[model samples]
Target chain A: MLLKPKTSILQKIYLPDIIIGLWITIKNFFFGKKVTIQYPEERRNYSSRLRGMHYIKTINGVENCTACMLCPTVCPAECIHIVAGERPDKEKYPISFEVDVLRCCFCGMCEEACPKDAIKLSNIYEMSMLKRSVYEKDFLLEQRGHK
Target chain B: MDFIDWIILGIKIGALLIALLSVAPVMSWVERRGSALMQNRLGPNRVGPFGLIQPIADAVKFMFKEDPVPGHVSKFYYVLAPLIAFIPALTTFSVIPFASSIEVMGRVVRFQVADLNVGFLYIFAIAALGIYGVVVAGWASNNKYSLLGSVRSSSQMISYELSMGLSVIGVIMIFSSVNLNDIVRDQGNVLFHLGQFAIPKWGIFVQPLGFLIFLITVFAETNRLPFDLPEGDSEIIAGYHLEYGSMKFAMFMMAEYINMATVSGLLATLYFGGWQMLPGMHTLLESFSLSGSLSGITYEWVRIVFEMFSFVIKVAFFMWFFVWVRWTLPRFRFDQLMGFGWKVMFPLSLVNILLTGIFIKVM
Candidate 1:
């Protein structure tokens, strides 16, 4: 459909319309409240259920992961590699647990699949790395989670 | 010229150069921070207090970065283009009076480098040469986008220059002088008086339509936003300077900002009262009895300082106006821009000149 531009003689003059624009900008410059957070000095709070970096939960210095295959089965990316082993104290434990961060889709299926609540998606979102990293079992445990 | 006159001339040139050179970096900082403030964001506030030293950091970064000249580009014009761009911008300021003359040791010193008898002509001539820089850069780059940008830029500038030159003819007629200093001095008298209220004879008050035409044309000639088809990032991908890098690119950026500053100064000088103190400023200065306490302080010197301050304020407002308009308005389509320049601006400026002539004769 073709439409004619809606312009009055005043607008056609251009000067008056431009002056109105100049007024609004000047008003904002002097009086408008800015919404900038100024990173490194101020930060926004994330919700409790916010999903970010991956972490393995621990209780009393013992890993809660029971080498449950449900998480790996549920994971769409198939990035989780867990090697289960029978130890002296524990009936079943993950001897070698690795998460290929490059491949992981960050869907948080592992957290929902864990029956023991051993795996979780933390709110610590600063996960930038210089190289492709595979999160080892040792690095996944401890109080590293922000949430 | 005598020995003292030569010395004074050298000092004037040096002072103007230093002032203009320093303003480029300061303008970069202002543009960034001012845009951020208007858009509800903080821009470059990490380097120093309110990011005051951000331009310095940017300069350092640009210095360390590797500059690569693309192999396909013509080597000679590529090297000369930035110099051509920069020199015109710097030289335009030589004729613009920053402040009225001050008496120092019984000698009169004007706050301008070289106030040519025909300063308006000199400025317009230098400005006309500025298009060559963009055209040369675009043609030498051997890129399709650059060539298109150059073509667009040259056409746009040429079209607007006609209206701009025509618009100023009204002011020239009213002032009866081509010298900028004389024009500025001519604006000092009262235009009209009704009872106690008086209107200072500013160009904006008398030749308002001409002023409007001149203002719009200046923005287009400077290749600013809403008319910035030459450097249309979305369309031409950095335009004429697409192949330029490091300091060569920096020089173009400097040229652009300096051009902006010079235009703003000219706007203030030509339309708003240039270096003329705001109304009642002299009375306000006289009301203060601080002069009696100081031994050698003269009221003339005090008034000159006030006038200089007023000039600075007007120029600064225009600078802010430039940045403000840039963020507010969207870019004009190439055809729309040309159409407006010829069809709208040209006829309007001609009408303005006609009205001014009739009014002058009748009055």
Candidate 2:
């Protein structure tokens, strides 16, 4: 694990970083202020270009997803899977679909590679779940968030 | 016997006042200066030539600042907290023996105030009392963060006090004296001279491990770097004194600095031979032109002055050292700090005591 020469006379078996860490503390204490910046008064700066949570675009309740299987192949983590069936118009559409977000690497390649532009990756990153199964959702309804 | 001694008493009182005042400001300056150097930055140089009168400016600002009491707090305890923090810090110095006594105007005047046999015990008791102020400050504030900080501080200090007391027991056995002067006197002994070098072997040499343990314990007790968990600025927001402002906040700080100075002085007296020059240096000084005995009153005055200088130099060096160490080390985390004190320091202290016993018997 060590980068230094093995036969070097001062090659210490134990790392002495603990003492160095202490010294660093001493340095910071003297150098920096307590910096109890009033939270409301002093807001941390965020870049304007930063993408946040996702939003879905819909026209009169019609959506673009179209049960595309192309997204499933493009996902690096193999998180996307879709089951398709014939609609009343005889056009094929997805009957069942699931995104195993637990396995998702979030590379966003699936959205970019979609040929029909039907799938889009959401900007949302604040997702949390107590159980892995909770992340394995059955549907993608936006406004009605999960309990 | 008459009018002049009355004048002399006034002069002594004036001197003591001056001494205390100078030490206070100088200690502040030293702390800031040492911190600056340690941090690789310039400290307080704007006012009065490298911030010499900074303490005066600070004192003035404190005096003029508006005092506030939150409606949720207990007025009595809030007001009392600062005093509790400040008093014990200054009081512990009363038993210190600075130097030897000499005859002045046909009367013997000791260099120190009353020396108590239980001097070290008195220090322990006084320092322990400081926790009460911190605890009460937290409880009276009605702030969750401050309350938690105060509780943590009182508990941490109380727990470490055991190891602190245990660590110093070896010194007690070695010198068998709680009176600081006696401790210094015992350490001044030289069994033999080594060629050109005289050996008045300091306590540090004989008990390096005890010295190390004592140093670590004192750092925790004084609430300084690495051990300053109570005042963890980031996580705790000024700890017990978070709710306090103006002069009250200033008082807590003043107490902490005074504790630093007090502990540093105690360290010097305990391990570094109080005011005495080290062994070879003592011999070298003896070899100088003034080698013979002196019986005159002038000689007595000269001796007193020199001894006082020795004590001052020793105490000042140790105070500087406290700042040096503060800048040289980092703070420990809550869990790590507790682990270090209880698991590491306490056990090592017991082992040190055993080793000291072995050394005493074998040596």
Candidate 3:
């Protein structure tokens, strides 16, 4: 169904309508609240569940992973690499862990697949870098983001 | 002219040129920020405070950019078009009086560049030539869209100029002079006294319909929004200046803003009591007794300054009004624009002139 708008004689003349339009714009120009956010100095808060950068969780300065290799096995992008080695303090501990961040799909499946709850996603989304590099174990241990 | 007179004339010309040239950059900033405000956004606040210097930065960029003459265009007219467009826009400001005359060094100095006897006729003549720039640019560019834009522009200007000229007849009859200074002086009279409150004989009060017609026609004359069919970006892709680059395009932009300022000044001069002090200013000045206390020369200087200030404020308001209306109204379709001009405004202005003539005759 087509609906025709009923316009009066004053509306047809257009002077009154033009004045009303001008009034609306002037009102907005004077009283409308600005919605711009200065980007560099101000940041918006995101929810804790936001999947951003990958991180390794630690408890009492020790690794929670038992070198089970579950996260790497569950990764869809095949971005995680691990080599397991034993230490005297712990019977089963991984010698090296790296996540290829550039290839990361950020699916959070690896976090879910980890039996020890060692790997977690955090909310540090500003990940621009000058060089392409993998996230090494030592670099991932800094705990820079909010989960 | 004598030596002092020559110096004063030189001063007036220099001041007017500076004021006209500076309006472009200032208006560009205002257009951006003002439109942003209307749209509920903050625009260009990064470069200098509130983006005031953004236009300056843009000017520098325009100056340094590569100015390539497209191989397809007619070289001579392409080079001449921007100059043709820009010069008339600046020249039309010569006849407009910024303030009434003041006594300086035993000589009367008028704050105008050239007080032509046919004041507004000179303006109309010069301003009409600006269309040549657009037309020539379109013809020279060897492009279909540019040609179309130029054709539209010429026709639009010709159609609207008639009604514009006719509308001003009412004002010319009321003021009884073509001299802008005399017209402004006439507007300073008290129309009638109602108890203590007085109504000055401003053109807007006596010639309301004429003012309305003149205002609408001025928008069409300047090729501003609702009448900016020539440079219709969505259709013609910048129209006549489509092939122009760098400083050439900048020249066109400068000419546009300058034309806007000139017409705004013309509007204020004709309708809104140009350089006449605002209401209550006389009472305020009298209450302070500044006129009685000051020496003759000092009082003249003070009055001249105040009048100039008043004129500037009026012109500035109209300038902002151009931006306000630009953001408020959407562009008119080409046929609608022409129809409105001929069918509606043309007949209305004719009626207005007839009515004013009858009113004057009866009185």
- Indicate which candidate wins on DockQ: 3
Model 2: per-residue Cα lDDT at residue A120: 50
DockQ of each: 0.73, 0.10, 0.75
Shift of residue B337 alpha carbon in model 3, Å: 1.1
Candidate models: Cα lDDT each: 0.88, 0.72, 0.91
Instruction: Name the TM-score of candidate 1.
Output: 0.95
Better of 1 and 2 by lDDT: 1
For model 3, residues B1-363, the per-residue Cα lDDT tens digits are 878778888888998999998999999999999999999998988899989999999999999999999999999999999999999999999999999998776787888889889989899999999999999999999999999999999999999999999999999999999899999999999888989888899999889999999999999999899899999999999899999999999999999999999998899899989989888777765654654685567777777877888899999999998999999988899999989999999999999999999989987
Give, for candidate 3 chain B, the lowest lDDT window spanning 10 residues. B283-292
Candidate 3's C-alpha runs over 4 A off are A1-4, A58-107, A114-119, A132-139, B288-291
Give the alpha carbon lDDT tens digit for every residue of A10-111 in model 2: 333212554665567566765655433334466554454333322223335544556667778888888777788776853776666677777777676766
CAPRI grade, predicted model 1: medium
Q: What is the TM-score, restricted to chain A, for candidate 3?
A: 0.81
Q: Rank the candidates by DockQ, best first.
A: 3, 1, 2
Candidate 2 accuracy as TM-score: 0.68
lDDT of 1 by residue, B66-182 (tens): 988899999999989989998999999888888889788878888878879987788889988888999999999999999999999999998999999999999998999888899
Q: After superposition, how far is residue A71 of candidate 2 from its true place, in Å?
A: 49
Candidate ranking under TM-score, highest first, comes to: 1, 3, 2
